[model samples]
Target chain A: MGMPLELNTMIVTKGREKRVEENLFVLVKEGYRLYPIDIPIDVKKTMDSDSSGSAVIKKVEWENSSTTITYQLVSLNSTN
Target chain B: MGMPLELNTMIVTKGREKRVEENLFVLVKEGYRLYPIDIPIDVKKTMDSDSSGSAVIKKVEWENSSTTITYQLVSLNSTN
Candidate 1:
Protein backbone atom coordinates (compact mmCIF):
# COMPACT_ATOMS: atom_id res chain seq x y z
CA MET A 1 0.00 0.00 0.00
CA GLY A 2 1.02 3.60 -0.34
CA MET A 3 0.09 5.75 2.65
CA PRO A 4 -2.31 4.31 5.20
CA LEU A 5 -5.61 5.96 6.06
CA GLU A 6 -5.40 8.08 9.19
CA LEU A 7 -7.81 7.47 12.06
CA ASN A 8 -8.17 9.72 15.07
CA THR A 9 -8.90 8.20 18.43
CA MET A 10 -9.57 9.36 21.97
CA ILE A 11 -9.29 7.56 25.30
CA VAL A 12 -11.65 9.48 27.57
CA THR A 13 -10.23 7.74 30.65
CA LYS A 14 -13.85 6.72 31.19
CA GLY A 15 -12.17 3.30 30.92
CA ARG A 16 -13.38 2.29 27.49
CA GLU A 17 -9.85 1.88 26.14
CA LYS A 18 -10.25 -1.84 25.74
CA ARG A 19 -13.54 -1.52 23.95
CA VAL A 20 -12.10 1.18 21.77
CA GLU A 21 -9.10 -0.98 20.92
CA GLU A 22 -11.50 -3.75 20.09
CA ASN A 23 -13.26 -1.32 17.81
CA LEU A 24 -10.00 -0.36 16.14
CA PHE A 25 -8.81 -3.93 15.84
CA VAL A 26 -11.97 -4.73 13.94
CA LEU A 27 -10.70 -2.45 11.23
CA VAL A 28 -7.20 -3.95 11.24
CA LYS A 29 -8.39 -7.52 10.63
CA GLU A 30 -9.97 -6.27 7.43
CA GLY A 31 -6.66 -5.56 5.61
CA TYR A 32 -5.32 -2.12 6.35
CA ARG A 33 -2.04 -1.81 8.24
CA LEU A 34 -1.83 0.03 11.55
CA TYR A 35 0.53 2.90 12.37
CA PRO A 36 0.15 5.45 15.14
CA ILE A 37 0.47 9.04 14.05
CA ASP A 38 3.39 10.58 15.89
CA ILE A 39 2.43 14.02 17.06
CA PRO A 40 2.30 16.02 20.22
CA ILE A 41 -0.71 14.76 22.14
CA ASP A 42 -3.32 17.48 21.98
CA VAL A 43 -5.77 18.20 24.77
CA LYS A 44 -8.80 18.53 22.55
CA LYS A 45 -12.48 18.27 23.40
CA THR A 46 -14.29 15.33 21.84
CA MET A 47 -17.57 13.47 21.93
CA ASP A 48 -18.75 12.05 25.28
CA SER A 49 -19.28 13.58 28.69
CA ASP A 50 -15.62 13.93 29.57
CA SER A 51 -14.54 17.55 29.67
CA SER A 52 -11.18 16.56 28.21
CA GLY A 53 -11.53 15.38 24.61
CA SER A 54 -8.62 12.95 25.33
CA ALA A 55 -7.37 12.04 21.85
CA VAL A 56 -6.74 8.33 21.27
CA ILE A 57 -3.21 7.80 20.01
CA LYS A 58 -1.15 4.83 18.70
CA LYS A 59 -3.01 4.88 15.33
CA VAL A 60 -1.82 2.57 12.54
CA GLU A 61 0.11 1.84 9.36
CA TRP A 62 -0.98 2.20 5.71
CA GLU A 63 -0.80 4.69 2.85
CA ASN A 64 2.10 6.64 1.35
CA SER A 65 2.59 8.93 4.35
CA SER A 66 -0.42 11.25 3.99
CA THR A 67 0.07 12.48 7.60
CA THR A 68 -3.62 12.24 8.57
CA ILE A 69 -7.17 11.53 7.42
CA THR A 70 -9.06 14.28 5.62
CA TYR A 71 -12.61 15.36 4.73
CA GLN A 72 -15.12 18.16 5.41
CA LEU A 73 -18.63 17.99 6.78
CA VAL A 74 -21.33 18.40 4.12
CA SER A 75 -24.66 17.68 5.82
CA LEU A 76 -26.58 17.26 9.04
CA ASN A 77 -28.21 14.14 7.67
CA SER A 78 -25.92 11.41 6.18
CA THR A 79 -28.22 9.44 3.81
CA ASN A 80 -25.43 8.08 1.60
CA MET B 1 -8.53 2.97 -6.35
CA GLY B 2 -10.24 -0.37 -5.81
CA MET B 3 -12.80 -1.07 -3.06
CA PRO B 4 -12.92 1.74 -0.56
CA LEU B 5 -12.20 1.16 3.12
CA GLU B 6 -15.15 -0.07 5.17
CA LEU B 7 -16.02 1.64 8.45
CA ASN B 8 -18.72 0.46 10.83
CA THR B 9 -20.94 3.12 12.36
CA MET B 10 -23.91 3.39 14.64
CA ILE B 11 -26.32 6.29 15.19
CA VAL B 12 -27.83 5.92 18.60
CA THR B 13 -30.65 8.40 19.11
CA LYS B 14 -28.32 10.04 21.64
CA GLY B 15 -27.97 13.14 19.45
CA ARG B 16 -24.29 13.00 18.54
CA GLU B 17 -24.93 12.22 14.88
CA LYS B 18 -23.69 15.61 13.78
CA ARG B 19 -20.56 15.32 15.85
CA VAL B 20 -19.90 11.82 14.56
CA GLU B 21 -20.37 12.94 10.97
CA GLU B 22 -18.00 15.74 11.67
CA ASN B 23 -15.65 13.09 12.95
CA LEU B 24 -16.05 10.93 9.84
CA PHE B 25 -15.70 13.88 7.47
CA VAL B 26 -12.35 14.63 9.02
CA LEU B 27 -11.16 11.34 7.57
CA VAL B 28 -12.66 11.78 4.11
CA LYS B 29 -10.93 14.92 2.88
CA GLU B 30 -7.69 13.19 3.84
CA GLY B 31 -7.83 11.12 0.59
CA TYR B 32 -10.60 8.66 1.28
CA ARG B 33 -13.86 8.17 -0.64
CA LEU B 34 -16.73 6.87 1.51
CA TYR B 35 -19.55 4.46 0.60
CA PRO B 36 -22.18 3.09 2.92
CA ILE B 37 -22.24 -0.69 3.21
CA ASP B 38 -25.93 -1.39 2.66
CA ILE B 39 -26.83 -3.71 5.47
CA PRO B 40 -29.90 -3.89 7.65
CA ILE B 41 -29.04 -1.40 10.35
CA ASP B 42 -28.10 -3.73 13.15
CA VAL B 43 -29.45 -2.83 16.59
CA LYS B 44 -26.27 -3.42 18.49
CA LYS B 45 -24.84 -2.00 21.72
CA THR B 46 -21.85 0.33 21.45
CA MET B 47 -19.40 2.27 23.55
CA ASP B 48 -21.31 5.05 25.26
CA SER B 49 -24.04 5.81 27.70
CA ASP B 50 -26.43 5.23 24.84
CA SER B 51 -27.97 1.74 24.93
CA SER B 52 -27.86 1.26 21.19
CA GLY B 53 -24.50 1.57 19.43
CA SER B 54 -25.96 3.07 16.29
CA ALA B 55 -23.66 2.20 13.37
CA VAL B 56 -22.53 5.12 11.22
CA ILE B 57 -22.88 4.50 7.48
CA LYS B 58 -21.72 5.96 4.11
CA LYS B 59 -18.02 5.13 4.44
CA VAL B 60 -15.48 6.47 1.90
CA GLU B 61 -13.27 5.79 -1.09
CA TRP B 62 -9.52 5.04 -1.43
CA GLU B 63 -7.17 2.11 -1.81
CA ASN B 64 -7.50 -0.94 -4.05
CA SER B 65 -10.89 -2.30 -2.87
CA SER B 66 -9.82 -4.05 0.31
CA THR B 67 -13.30 -3.65 1.87
CA THR B 68 -12.25 -2.24 5.28
CA ILE B 69 -9.39 -1.13 7.47
CA THR B 70 -7.56 -3.96 9.19
CA TYR B 71 -5.47 -4.64 12.32
CA GLN B 72 -5.60 -6.53 15.63
CA LEU B 73 -5.42 -5.31 19.19
CA VAL B 74 -1.97 -6.23 20.46
CA SER B 75 -1.69 -4.48 23.76
CA LEU B 76 -3.56 -2.99 26.69
CA ASN B 77 -1.38 0.08 26.45
CA SER B 78 -0.98 1.06 22.79
CA THR B 79 2.57 2.53 22.63
CA ASN B 80 2.89 2.35 18.82
Candidate 2:
Protein backbone atom coordinates (compact mmCIF):
# COMPACT_ATOMS: atom_id res chain seq x y z
CA MET A 1 0.00 0.00 0.00
CA GLY A 2 1.02 3.61 -0.50
CA MET A 3 0.83 6.51 1.95
CA PRO A 4 -1.49 9.42 1.28
CA LEU A 5 0.43 12.57 0.46
CA GLU A 6 -0.32 15.94 -1.08
CA LEU A 7 2.01 17.81 -3.37
CA ASN A 8 1.60 21.55 -2.95
CA THR A 9 2.82 24.33 -5.19
CA MET A 10 2.17 27.21 -2.80
CA ILE A 11 1.80 28.03 0.88
CA VAL A 12 -1.37 28.98 2.74
CA THR A 13 -0.21 30.17 6.15
CA LYS A 14 -3.64 31.53 7.28
CA GLY A 15 -1.89 34.00 9.65
CA ARG A 16 -0.13 31.33 11.66
CA GLU A 17 3.49 31.81 10.67
CA LYS A 18 6.36 32.63 13.02
CA ARG A 19 9.48 34.48 12.01
CA VAL A 20 12.57 32.55 12.99
CA GLU A 21 15.08 34.96 11.50
CA GLU A 22 15.31 37.78 9.03
CA ASN A 23 13.28 36.76 5.98
CA LEU A 24 12.98 33.23 7.28
CA PHE A 25 9.62 31.95 8.58
CA VAL A 26 8.12 28.73 9.81
CA LEU A 27 4.56 27.46 9.54
CA VAL A 28 2.80 24.33 10.65
CA LYS A 29 -0.22 22.86 8.96
CA GLU A 30 -2.54 19.94 9.58
CA GLY A 31 -1.81 17.02 7.21
CA TYR A 32 0.82 15.25 5.16
CA ARG A 33 1.86 17.71 2.48
CA LEU A 34 4.91 18.12 0.31
CA TYR A 35 6.45 21.14 -1.35
CA PRO A 36 9.35 21.63 -3.68
CA ILE A 37 12.51 22.40 -1.75
CA ASP A 38 15.04 25.10 -2.63
CA ILE A 39 12.63 26.45 -5.21
CA PRO A 40 10.68 29.70 -5.03
CA ILE A 41 6.95 29.34 -4.36
CA ASP A 42 4.12 31.77 -3.75
CA VAL A 43 3.15 32.52 -0.17
CA LYS A 44 -0.36 33.59 0.66
CA LYS A 45 -2.01 34.46 3.94
CA THR A 46 -4.91 32.26 2.93
CA MET A 47 -5.89 30.18 -0.03
CA ASP A 48 -8.25 32.86 -1.23
CA SER A 49 -5.87 35.70 -0.48
CA ASP A 50 -3.60 37.30 -2.98
CA SER A 51 0.02 36.34 -3.18
CA SER A 52 1.84 38.15 -0.39
CA GLY A 53 5.34 37.20 -1.38
CA SER A 54 7.58 34.62 -2.94
CA ALA A 55 9.42 32.18 -0.71
CA VAL A 56 11.87 29.37 -1.11
CA ILE A 57 11.05 26.34 0.96
CA LYS A 58 14.12 25.19 2.81
CA LYS A 59 12.55 22.47 4.90
CA VAL A 60 9.38 20.41 5.02
CA GLU A 61 8.69 18.21 8.03
CA TRP A 62 5.73 15.93 8.60
CA GLU A 63 5.05 14.51 12.04
CA ASN A 64 2.11 13.59 14.22
CA SER A 65 -0.15 14.02 11.21
CA SER A 66 1.06 17.59 10.83
CA THR A 67 3.32 19.30 8.34
CA THR A 68 5.89 21.93 9.25
CA ILE A 69 7.72 24.02 6.71
CA THR A 70 10.58 26.47 6.86
CA TYR A 71 10.87 29.05 4.12
CA GLN A 72 12.75 32.23 3.28
CA LEU A 73 11.07 35.24 1.78
CA VAL A 74 12.98 36.18 -1.31
CA SER A 75 10.58 38.79 -2.69
CA LEU A 76 7.45 40.55 -1.51
CA ASN A 77 4.60 41.52 -3.77
CA SER A 78 3.74 44.38 -1.45
CA THR A 79 5.38 45.94 1.59
CA ASN A 80 2.15 46.61 3.38
CA MET B 1 24.72 17.65 -11.15
CA GLY B 2 22.62 15.75 -8.63
CA MET B 3 22.12 16.95 -5.06
CA PRO B 4 24.32 15.41 -2.37
CA LEU B 5 22.03 13.29 -0.23
CA GLU B 6 22.60 10.70 2.48
CA LEU B 7 20.17 7.89 3.06
CA ASN B 8 20.11 7.01 6.75
CA THR B 9 18.54 3.92 8.19
CA MET B 10 18.87 5.09 11.79
CA ILE B 11 18.72 8.26 13.88
CA VAL B 12 21.73 9.79 15.63
CA THR B 13 20.31 12.36 18.05
CA LYS B 14 23.60 13.27 19.78
CA GLY B 15 21.58 14.16 22.93
CA ARG B 16 20.02 17.14 21.18
CA GLU B 17 16.43 15.98 21.11
CA LYS B 18 13.49 17.89 22.55
CA ARG B 19 10.29 16.23 23.63
CA VAL B 20 7.27 17.46 21.76
CA GLU B 21 4.86 15.14 23.52
CA GLU B 22 4.94 11.91 25.42
CA ASN B 23 6.84 9.40 23.28
CA LEU B 24 7.31 11.93 20.52
CA PHE B 25 10.57 13.83 20.00
CA VAL B 26 12.16 16.25 17.60
CA LEU B 27 15.80 16.42 16.66
CA VAL B 28 17.76 18.82 14.49
CA LYS B 29 21.12 18.01 12.98
CA GLU B 30 23.63 19.40 10.58
CA GLY B 31 23.49 18.65 6.82
CA TYR B 32 20.81 17.09 4.63
CA ARG B 33 19.97 13.51 5.50
CA LEU B 34 17.19 11.09 4.69
CA TYR B 35 15.52 8.48 6.88
CA PRO B 36 12.93 5.79 6.42
CA ILE B 37 9.52 7.27 7.14
CA ASP B 38 6.55 5.44 8.66
CA ILE B 39 8.89 2.64 9.64
CA PRO B 40 10.68 1.89 12.86
CA ILE B 41 14.38 2.64 12.97
CA ASP B 42 17.05 2.58 15.65
CA VAL B 43 17.65 5.68 17.74
CA LYS B 44 20.97 6.36 19.38
CA LYS B 45 22.52 9.07 21.48
CA THR B 46 25.43 9.27 19.08
CA MET B 47 26.95 7.49 16.14
CA ASP B 48 29.14 5.43 18.48
CA SER B 49 26.45 4.90 21.14
CA ASP B 50 24.19 1.92 21.52
CA SER B 51 20.61 1.94 20.40
CA SER B 52 18.54 3.88 22.91
CA GLY B 53 15.26 2.86 21.36
CA SER B 54 13.29 2.29 18.20
CA ALA B 55 11.41 5.14 16.64
CA VAL B 56 9.08 5.71 13.73
CA ILE B 57 10.07 8.78 11.77
CA LYS B 58 6.99 10.86 11.03
CA LYS B 59 8.63 13.79 9.36
CA VAL B 60 11.95 14.91 7.93
CA GLU B 61 12.83 18.45 6.96
CA TRP B 62 15.92 19.90 5.37
CA GLU B 63 16.60 23.60 5.31
CA ASN B 64 19.49 26.03 5.60
CA SER B 65 22.00 23.19 5.35
CA SER B 66 20.35 21.55 8.36
CA THR B 67 18.08 18.59 8.79
CA THR B 68 15.16 18.37 11.20
CA ILE B 69 13.37 15.16 12.06
CA THR B 70 10.36 14.22 14.13
CA TYR B 71 9.85 10.70 15.34
CA GLN B 72 7.82 8.78 17.88
CA LEU B 73 9.55 6.39 20.21
CA VAL B 74 7.98 2.97 20.02
CA SER B 75 10.25 1.10 22.37
CA LEU B 76 13.15 1.94 24.66
CA ASN B 77 16.01 -0.38 25.41
CA SER B 78 16.54 1.15 28.84
CA THR B 79 14.44 2.74 31.53
CA ASN B 80 17.12 5.01 32.87
> Model 2, range B1-80, lDDT digits (tens) per residue?
42456768899888899999999999987777766678888999889888999999887877777788888999999747
Error of 2 at A65 (Å): 1.2
Candidate 1 chain B minimal-lDDT segment of 10 residues: B69-78
Predicted complex 2: DockQ: 0.35
The DockQ of predicted model 1 stands at 0.02
Q: Model 2 over residues A1-80: C-alpha lDDT tens digits? A: 43566768899989999999999999998877767678788999988889999999888777777788989999999656
Model 1 residue B11 lDDT score: 24
Per-residue lDDT, model 2, residue B61, is 75
Highest DockQ: which candidate?
Answer: 2
The regions of model 2 sitting more than 4 angstroms off are B1-36, B40-55, B64-80
The weakest ten consecutive residues by lDDT in model 1 chain A span A69-78
Model 2 lDDT, residue B17, Cα: 95
Looking at model 2 chain B, which ten-residue stretch has the lowest summed lDDT? B1-10
lDDT of all predictions, in order shown? 0.31, 0.84
